[model samples]
Target: MRISFSEWTKSGSPWVWLNAGAVAISIIMVVGLLALIAVRGLGHFWPADVIQADYEENGRQRTIIGELVEREMVPAPQLRGAGIEVPEGVEAMARDLIKVGNRDFGSADFIWAMDHFITHTQRPAMLFAAERLEWGNFYGYLREVKEAGQSVGRHTGYEKTQEYLTLWAEFQQRIDRVLDIREQILSIEKKDIGSINYEIERLRLKERSLDLEQSTDTAAYAKIEARRSELNAEYEQLQQRLTDLYQQINRDTFVAEIADGREVEIAVAKIVRAFLPNDMGLAAKIIHYAEKVWEFLSDEPREANTEGGIFPAIFGTVMMVILMSVLVTPFGVIAAVYLREYAKQGFITRLIRIAVNNLAGVPSIVYGVFGLGFFVYFLGGHIDDLFFPEAKPSPTFGTGGLMWASITLALLTVPVVIVATEEGLARIPRAVREGSLALGATKFETLWKVVLPMASPAMMTGVILAIARAAGEVAPLMLVGVVKLAPSLPLDTNYPYLHLDQKFMHLGFHIYDVGFQSPNVEAARPLVYATALLLVVVIALLNFSAIAIRNHLREKYKALEM
Candidate 1:
């Protein structure tokens, strides 16, 4: 029998259990989602055994070599919809999604086949997988090693696996050297050359400015031209060095036999990693997994961001959040102080507070449009005309970039900060302010010295909330600064160090790009999970830092707060 409402209220057990159950369910849901993401995303790094299957397709018997990525049961109707015949009385058909990765040799890297059609399947110990710089992975049997188009060693049959492993060690050494040289060349081109180009542009602008002012400074032009000549000379030397490095890197190559018996010779420089997954021990597999994770974290994304790392996106996200917090904090705190301490309590103040609370609920996309129109086009165009007249016809600050993006987010999150800070100021004991005033302190002095310190913990809470919100923002950033791929970071070794006008990548946009816009869906799916997990972790870390600072401030002002 159900208990009476009055008795249940008196007991309080029902309400207590209800609240506990809600909390437990929430915790379970969050943990379960994280686990699902971790399993799917992190598993991509681990080595899986290579399977060789003999199957009949379109009345032809063929051998397929690849790794089994997934297995699923499909309804008979679904298979029939795709023009595949299903036998009578069969409810479902088992299918396998195999990663038969040789994109350069075929149209797609992943293949789906009906499991029932397979004649046989075996885990071959000799099958090899080579991760490359372009066109994804190549799974095959090792054929031969070559240098300058001359064969050094050849492998065939089951015995070839041991021979290939020996040569693979040598290839790894060559690959390491090539990667180092490539990195050096990239540094010279992007950093050194980029800096020179920037300086040249600055000089051009300066010369134009001088001409506009009608300055008769021959020595200034002479100095600028001399510096340009010096930079040009250095650039030429770097170009020669790059040429030599490229030639050296392209000297080695290797041949591999695909399942159909076609031999393809791939340049050693193009290979990122080569391994026999079927033969790897547990310890070796662990090392490989660690290496893959590091590459995902540190390397520049390739193959439409489905392959390699997301360092640029991670950097942009953190940088933008920091800029937003810097911009929003002071403005929010000052406005809050003015309203809570200095303002005359009236209808106008109440209206403003109401407007602010409403602003918090405004659609983020609307803010993005406002930012683009006002900050990017109108105000930015005016600033460009006034300050950067020498670079006319092309917009610098007149375009969507890091500064405007940060400013947009600042405006979006400032309402939260203001509301929180106002509440904090209201919580300061009236005795503290009166005590300061009695000691000959002015109103301003009392508020700054006595009231603000006591309210700082609450201010930190507001900032923490702002950071949590701003870091996950994608829509506004897309209209302002976020791009699918940014060639250079906003902050770099260029003049002024931080280029506020530069476009940047963000993790949120990257996830959207790889998950939806990528050409390879199966390959990008795991990356989406990985990137999503990473975004969560990044937000958590940022919040934790703010929370730590908040805790310290709260402790320091505990007595004052009381």
Candidate 2:
């Protein structure tokens, strides 16, 4: 206890304890944040009981059927400010945020009601939560299945549910058929006819080129016209087929009775899912939760991204990071190698190093602006003119897209790689280099055979950091390539499988859009947390993979370091 400060410093135990404490605090903070995110995000998928509560508001009593989404206690002053009269001496008011999801019938899907005003609360076992195509979730009673405006099933009350279940099963079959037909239509329109149009355009461009060269031949023109006629005939056939498919899809309908006893006829094709949550047992609820999670992972977003999944965003984030890694690695390694191994250690080299270090500290948004100007406008415009002249007037590479976004991120992160690599090169023992040289190896050969391999772990470490930063970046991506909803994936079974010119969605941008830019803030909040959790997990996995590789390399080269 009486030890001198100098002695304590020399012992190094205090410093070690401080370092340990810092690491422990950091880990606790990270874990706590992740847990919070998981709780908010993952809970969104669980099946909750739908309560039919008789709520009295403004002296008017009405039945409200919806899921009890959340409960909160608000200050009495705040409630009074909102025109709600709180009792004398009351400090706060209890309120419930209910998701009364008859959006097509009501103007809003969510409502806030005073807890004390809610009475005659009942969890109806047969109340249905229908996820739809257009309006958000629908909470209602199943009236019966209908075909062409005629009822087909028994109107038995909630007790005799087997008839309703049969109708639901039949409705699901129709939905599947409609989905299949829609897929076929999409294939024809975007792929088959699209390819034909592309070919026709190619021919037209070729003819134009030939005319410009004064070599336009009658035979060539006739051949192109024949091909065009064939494409037109095929397109007509597809149009007729699509018309038939549309007619078939719109045939069946299901009638749902809302809380106000209004029967609404909803097309079977429009229903995404219909579930009776209160009737479900533990196993069924678990299964339903799993299905919802799967859909969230595998399906494309709809309804302003408040409904459905975010597969496109996930795919784009991964692909863009991979592209960035591929682009940044070589350039960073080359610059580092030259500066540390070949370039003379002069003021110029030091100045370059300083600039690189400063670049790392530069605001990422500045890089976004630079990328929009230099990469998207200047270089991409040039690429469009040189390579895709046929697609002029509309930008090909002359717009924000995958390649430019990847390159922009690569530029942003290359500094980390350069610094890590330089330090790694500096760490190689002098004797190792001399020994390589003594073996009659040239400087280049020695670097290739010994230095780079040993320094690779550091290179991987830099890449891991770069991936971690680039994957979660939103600002630059938004400016460069990310979109609210990408119509199609960048990779498709087209001429160029990976379409670098195509714009893509990113999870970071999705999170921002869902959390802030959404039209339905309450509905999108849980989604934001879930997406954030997923983004963290994805980055962690990527970093862990890189770390594993780095560890392996370090282990392999441990003897060399000694």
Candidate 3:
């Protein structure tokens, strides 16, 4: 207790405290970052109250209708630089960014106003925000509903209008009908007609194959023609149905009056949803939030990936990682087994081990370039030449796709697996191996049944680490398989259920594309955080599953180690 400061330092307690403090700080920083991401990402779905405000600008009061997005203090110099008139005594002025959702009015959807100039600001109960398919968002009052150019229902003041007889009610019914028909159109085009199109392509390829073979397959040609004729007939029938549906969906329109007193007639079909945020109750708001979150998780992104869901990206990320794991595990394990159990320990063996360890430290983009050059062009081109001669000129495997991406990642991560497995194999006591062999078990049997099973935990650890690294990788994926938007998912109900040749979307690439490449930065900011958070969660889930298996294996082999 009476130890001197020098003695205390010698006792290592100071160093321990230093380490503990550093660990605590690191944990705190990590938690804070995650919390920030969660808050920003999750808050986007909330039904924010829309304000109807009047602002004095250049001695004129103009009506502004939108949601208050943010508030900030701006120095007087900066404000003056922007040509804004600030009061003489003010060193700084407060500015508010308002989400004035009227992109159709030929100005930015977001506008900034000085707090001192904003005079009247109120959440108007009748002001509705319309979520549209094309024009981002529109904030206005529903003036009237029309069916075939005939006035159907007009909005009377809230108290006077019956619940079922309001223009909003008619708008809702027509929109619901439009949405239902839209679903039908999507199903026919994506599934039924998609299959027909796929078949047609296959037939074309088959005809090409016959031509290349120089075979007089007139019967085959006739059959292909008949099939094409049948498909054409079916397509024409579906085309008529699609035409009728489009007409019906477009028949209903609504007139909405903007803050500037201009009424725009919007086709009901263009609207995705409309809501009066101020009028929504707690339960209704919760439901709306849940629906939005679900849409974000399940729907395909639109609007340059600034709006809609990220299902394809999620699917691609998980699919590629799984495929990589499948490929890397066996090859890595075999290489590890050979090095650890069979290979003679020499200078060359040491060199190979050193090489592997160095490989892990190489830049991921280097792997991407190598994969593009070798796997896509060299290996894939050969495969196409041999197996897909009919599909000439069009690169199938000879392109950046799911297969090449997976293979590239597998090659990139295999070294980690090899090192972990070799270490695990080396940890097995020589007595245990000799004991198995003495009991009449062959070397392979002893290695398989005893050593490999015990090493499973370590192998799982390697795989988990690989997943953690590979999931967040965007650079290599861009050069290999990842794209801004994939027209079709790599997976489908086609002949080859898993189309390894197809380009895909990934959450990592999605974050990059949305965060930086989006045309609308204000709209895409929240989505970037949300997608990043989701990617973290996905990797965590994958690691957790691997960890669970590792734990089970460790437990099973606990007694053996003892």
**TM-score for each of the candidates:** 0.96, 0.94, 0.98
Give me the displacement of residue 82 in model 2, in angstroms. 2.9
- Give me the candidate number with maximum lDDT: 3
lDDT of 2 by residue, 121-161 (tens): 98877788888888899888877777777767746576636
TM-score of 2: 0.94
Among all windows of 10 consecutive residues in model 1, the one with the lowest summed lDDT is 158-167
lDDT of each: 0.89, 0.89, 0.91
lDDT of 3 by residue, 192-293 (tens): 888888989999999999999998989999999999999989988888988998888889999888888888888898889998899899999999999999
**Which regions of candidate 1 fall more than 4 Å away from where they truly are?**
1-5, 160-162
Per-residue lDDT tens digits of candidate 1, residues 228-337?
A: 89988988887888899889889888888887779898898888888888889999999999999999888889988989999999999999999999999999999999
Q: Which candidate leads the pack in TM-score?
A: 3
Rank by TM-score (best first): 3, 1, 2
lDDT of 1 at 513: 91
- Runs with alpha carbons beyond 4 Å of true place in candidate 3: 156-165
